[model samples]
Target: MSDQEIPAREPSWQSRRLLSDRLDWNLLRTFLVIGEEKSISRAAARLFLTQSAVSQSLKRLEEQLECALILRRGPRFDLSPAGEEVLRLAEEIYGNVSRLAATAKNPQDDVVGKVRILTISQVQSDLYDDFLIQLHRDHPRVELEIEVMRSADIQSSLNQKTATIGLGLCRFPQTKLERRRLLRQRYAFFCGKRHRLFGQRRLPLEALQGENFVSFTSDQLGGNLSPLTMFRDQQGFTGKIVASSSSFEEIRRLIIAGYGVGCLPEHLVDIDLHNGLIWRLPPAEGVVDVDVFLMWNREQRMNHAETVFLDSFRRLLEAAGEE
Candidate 1:
């Protein structure tokens, strides 16, 4: 029979077995890493593999599946339709594998298995390194998967059981979640060195009236009308808001550019204050204080490793005067 006219035959048991044996779990893992990072180089660096190896593995995975799973955009990788399906399946498969590993581990042995954490982006920048260092020192076998996102995203992840723990400013009560207060975060009003209030050690709240202001909004703060409320209700100051942003970095930059006076986390502007890049304005009343919290779902049962990690986090917060 001509090759084109020949009928397609179903694979035998032996052929099916051979194909199954050819499928590599490592390649699937590499694919998942690439999906998460969205960059081959980043995925390679995270996996501790050469860029070429990651590329080759991705190619192999696509070949084994007989379909393209990823598409390259201008400077980033995006999932194809097949890739989306694969990613969903891959997450479930890995989750099952993790559960199995956790179950198989000896109770008396070292704490092990992965802990997923969702935290505010700024909090991660400030505290993640210390937390990771301490966690590694205490339990070398434990692995951490961390996501730094907006506070709303963090809370959603916790509620959905996609994340094991969450840490951020808590302004609203969430049902079915347990919250542990970590610390009170203090905010300070600051002006750029070139601003009118720069030389003043502290300005009366009345002096701020009619001046320009910069504002920052965060999901963690929920609807707390902070600096405005402090100024209007308490201080009786009326200032025009010149700029607003969701990013604290943007707010800091705007303040540095002398756009307007802005309130910022004391920790974030300490160096700037010391260097005289920014000057703090003492409010006569109604200073902003946000309580930070470590939260987890109440319905979820904590494994030993998770319990230990939570304790460690609490201790760290206490030491930092956050708890």
Candidate 2:
């Protein structure tokens, strides 16, 4: 048989051997981060490693896989077809590893590991202090990563498994997530001490008909309608809005500066009300009520640290209610 006519051996065996080779899990983790962030610098920042180290790790990973996984496109990195397939498999690998790590911990050991929480900004201010203090006291080994996000984003993060828990105003239907009512946040009209109606006990709703009001913007309020609009439509308020802000603190400051009367959550202004810096006005007919919830992905398993933090949060709420 001529040498050229001999059957050529397929590369299947070599490819199978490469597939069976054990890769470093840490390197895979770095690759996953780079894949998700699409920037070596960003991934390095997230992983708390130097940019050069991440670059080297990526090089090593490609060498091990024996294929070019990523292609540099101007300022960003795009995954090659092989990279896409690897990323999909890497996600499953990491997901199973995470679940295994959660359950494989010694049952007798103290609660440990990181719990990522996503909450609304206002809700964080109201509860994080107490929650963090209690968490540290009870489970010193547990680390927390709290991100302030909009109410609309909180549930999405929970469903994506990016956040282990969420605390926010429950605006979505409870179809895919588990929700426990945490508290009823009350919103009512407020005025600074210098306001005309500050000293009055029972000012009528009609009295504010032409007054200017301060409130949060629609986006900040996490709804289609602004708080000012809700009050105007539901409580017979006819005030003109003089100012709007994305910051709750800014709105409070504006109200205190006598910019205009504003609606604020009771918890936010409780101290100001006590200090005589702000006064809570009578609701036109009733105060605006929002039900805040503790939410999580229904399908995810809660690790020990997460479970402990959740239980402590519930207790704190109960204690606050008693007071």
Candidate 3:
């Protein structure tokens, strides 16, 4: 046939590329949340959805899979055998998606993107200042946001893409994230200049056992379990916890006011110690080692700038550990 006489051919389905899949992927996500939480209400809360919505999603998933995924009782839910199988598949899909997302992210100098980082404890803020300085110096166009939150929220932030990185003392069971150890932060007991323990170079733990104490809530450390929790769990201390706050600034001020001896981050109290504003109580056997971690989304690929920042931060942590 001549070029002018050629017939127009229609596109075939086999040759067409689908931008979206036919299967309901959201159903699997809901299924995974339900399996992990073990309660529809809890899963709904985590998903920022209504109970009915979560239940509906589950029902839809069950219908599609042609199996009972959950057995509901009074305020509790259990996964059925079919649910267990579906869960395995869901995990595999989730893992693959995460890998794809990580692979897709490429470092670009244009279109300034915002990165939110969460901190588990104020203790890590000392290092954050230096890191921020370096970040600005390297990537002046990008905006950096930091949130000081509980460990639970930190993990949630990373999972939900609300935060790019988390610096915390506690670890959560997330199969989709990666962690880098920065340093093991140690705690030091602090008292004001006028307090009786101020003049002493070092004081024993027992010396302040009788002193009224200033303590922080678990929120300050980004975990529901605080170091003080360790004291109660292991020591069976029924004693009243005198003063409590979640802010490091508040704790510092309270300690300065001679409210009581407070457990302070070594880095935070360093300048104060040099100026004789606060004194450290002697080291004890019961000191809890706070392992500082740099948590990031394993599914998301690090860009050139992000990779450099992460590497430099890792190096700083390594240096601190050696010191």
Candidate 4:
């Protein structure tokens, strides 16, 4: 990819000491607000200052930096080259300061903010459940919003910084994301009660040849769930896929409703297997092992609740791993 042409900036800084002596935190904060709001009047309203006062702050910041911070006309506003760089640095500074405040809070203090999690369906695990239960008991004021999304959509959301956390299968390691293995799940082929092969045990690998199949949309993506697709190919199943879905529950419903045999997380189907609603199929020995990951955008500036919850959750994961 070609590099984007940046707006020309000043030659170079003369001395770090000189720059630090003249720079004020308030000026940088005001400029950051102007860059975000894109309007002097709006920024003044947010900062609870007069419009002229805000304009003076920006002018002071530009003069001290020896470069134009914002290029503004009668009403239109835009960030100059130096202004863009300053805004980024200012955001980083503020994020660190915010994190420090969250860190220094008393343990008894309430952590109050929302954490939006974009995840794939059927993430049933003891560790995950324990995390949630512990989170509620410790930080009752923290709010969580969970949304079930496709693997592709989850990745997109995290990249755009629209979602805070992601949990599920992923295609490959995204450079901007931080990931940890949250669970190692076993996947197995299963048939509904009404299927002819249901309840069968020790069936040969050839028995499922040309049998109809049901699966998740991700299975066809060539990225996520590559193991399931590879296993299907290795088993020599040439059957047409009768149904597919992005949701695990929907795929499970279709398979249990007798749409076709499908691969699902083994632990999630324990109750169904016990009740004879679905029966595990052949090749019982070499089940597919898929690692579910906990992922978040490295660029995102998380809220107080997010910072606290993740810290506690990581400790829980570490403790579990040691056992």
For residues 1-323, write the lDDT of model 2, one tens digit per residue. Answer: 32112232343667658755667778888988888778889999989999989988887777667666787766666887778888877776775565444444545567876678887766634465767876788777777777886676677656656567888866556677877777777778888988888878878777776778887775234472354475576656666778987667888999999988888778777789889999777764345777778888777667777777777776776677621
Clashing pairs in 4: none
RMSD of each: 8.0, 8.9, 11.9, 10.6
The 10-residue segment of model 4 with minimum total lDDT is 1-10
lDDT of 1 by residue, 160-225 (tens): 455678877557789977787755667777899879888795567677766788886652123533
lDDT tens digits, residue span 144-233, model 4: 889987777787667656567899787588989887778887888898998889877778978888789998787864768777788888
Best-to-worst ranking by TM-score: 4, 1, 2, 3
lDDT of 3: 0.66
Question: Please, what is the TM-score per model?
Answer: 0.61, 0.59, 0.55, 0.65
- What C-alpha lDDT values do all the predictions have? 0.72, 0.72, 0.66, 0.78
Q: Give the TM-score comparing model 3 with the true structure, all chains together.
A: 0.55
> Alpha-carbon error at 88 in model 1, in Å?
14
Question: After aligning candidate 3 to the native by TM-score, how far in Å is the CA of 192 from where it should be?
Answer: 14
Task: List residue ranges in candidate 3 displaced over 4 A.
Answer: 1-20, 95-118, 121-123, 139-149, 152-165, 170-236, 240-289, 295-306, 319-323
* TM-score of candidate 2 versus the correct structure, residues matched by position: 0.59
lDDT of 4: 0.78
Give the clashing pairs for model 1.
182-322, 182-323, 183-322
Instruction: Judging by lDDT against the true structure, name the best candidate.
Output: 4
